[model samples]
Target: MQQLAFYQSLWATERRRPGVPERPVSERFDAVKADGYHGMAIDLGAMTLEQARATVPEFARTGLGGLLTAFPQSVDDLRPAIRLAKDIGSPFLIVIGQVMPLSVAGMIPVIREWLALARAEGMPLQFETHRDCITNDLFATVQLLDAIPEMRMAADLSHYVVNREMLYPIRPEYRALISRVLARCDSFQGRVASRNQVQVPIGFPQHAKWVATFLDWWTEGLAGWRGRAGPDDTAIFMCELGPPEYALTDARGDELSDRRQEALQIRAMVEDRWKALGA
Candidate 1:
């Protein structure tokens, strides 16, 4: 049977602002496990490599599955992250490469180099669709997919939606672009976004249409995964509702909505979609 796993982002759990005290890593891990999450993602973009290394023992303590996300500026920088992912028992390492080039043609060899490094290390790597990374542009990313037939992606559709400044009633051209993206997606990240914002409060009435759009895309992505994946493989869906900048802040720097609740809600939504497929 195929499995679907939900992972909570440690970065999302942070509440570092003016008044609120930040939660300890231990408390955060405990909450993630207690909330019924099967895994936790350690984002190197938000923490130092040593800090990420320090958390491995805690994964064993909490019995939560582990994942590592790296923002490597060079292909060589990714090797240590690959080893760390192996140490943490992560199924794969998620790469959001910071090396941005002028053109998609320039990006092809960089990607191939990173994939070759991971292959050499005996680790699986998935390039993420995120802003400020090699796969930042939707149009360019589509070209990269064409250029590299074996490339698999960890889809975070929120970035593409905002990067393209998409509006409701998605155009056929944009829809075709998104379909190409979803077809290559090996993993997914959960965050509702409008064209203007990277992260929107999912329960807000104003965001309903965009929420519906993402759900439909996620369902399609899952169905595609079902068709392509091995019988016992697991689909990892990460709830990545980030803190501060990603979360909309009010006048006093307080988030407008409860992210913990929203993360759980996203988890439930994906779980329902997976089950509805009924193998």
Candidate 2:
């Protein structure tokens, strides 16, 4: 049957305290499993490949799902990342391509090659909408999607919002553009962002509208996926509320909200909306 699963990002747990040592991967996995997440996702940009490989046994021991987000700098760079993801037995691989091609036509071949390689390796892959990558620009990404019909995306609306410096009470043109994005999403990401900030505390009074807006987008995206996907397909919605820098910080450089709690809240919100989509 079609279903959705939630994951917590390992990077989200970073530097929760400035002077304190980071927790071990085994301990982190235990915490993720205890927190009732179905999986944990590791960021390649955050750790060396050897470091990522070291955690494979922990994922095996915990029996939780696994996912990898890769930052590939070239067409051939995806190879090892896919292999590591296979070791973790991830449901899919997310690529934030660092190969910046100035034009859409220039990008087409790079993306097509990555897709072909992943398909040959028997890995499911989707490019993530993020900053400082090939899909970084909103206009360029939309164009790339149209140019390559098979190119699937894992939507992280936070980057796009901040990228566009989107104004609130979103204009009709802005909503239309976002609708095109939602229509093409193969998966959804969790984070509430205003045009000014990349990540904000979800429960704050000022952030409520943005929260509501994100939920609306996710609901529309998932419902659309349900309509098109086969009965047995599964959907993944990862809660990637990142650490300070990604998170809003106080003057002291401390996080303004409990990120773990916010991640869970995002999961709950998505779960509620997914249930109401009807089987």
Top candidate on lDDT is 1
Model 1 Cα lDDT, one tens digit per residue, 1-279? 999999999999999797768988999999999999999999999999999999999899999999999999998999889988988889999999998999998999999999999989998889899999999999999999999998999999999999999978889999999999999999999999998999999999999999899999999999999999999999999999999888999998889999999999988988999999964
lDDT of 1: 0.93
lDDT of 2 by residue, 211-236 (tens): 99999999998998998999998888
> What's the lDDT for all of these models?
0.93, 0.89
Model 2 clashing residue pairs (backbone):
none
Q: Estimate each model's TM-score.
A: 0.98, 0.97
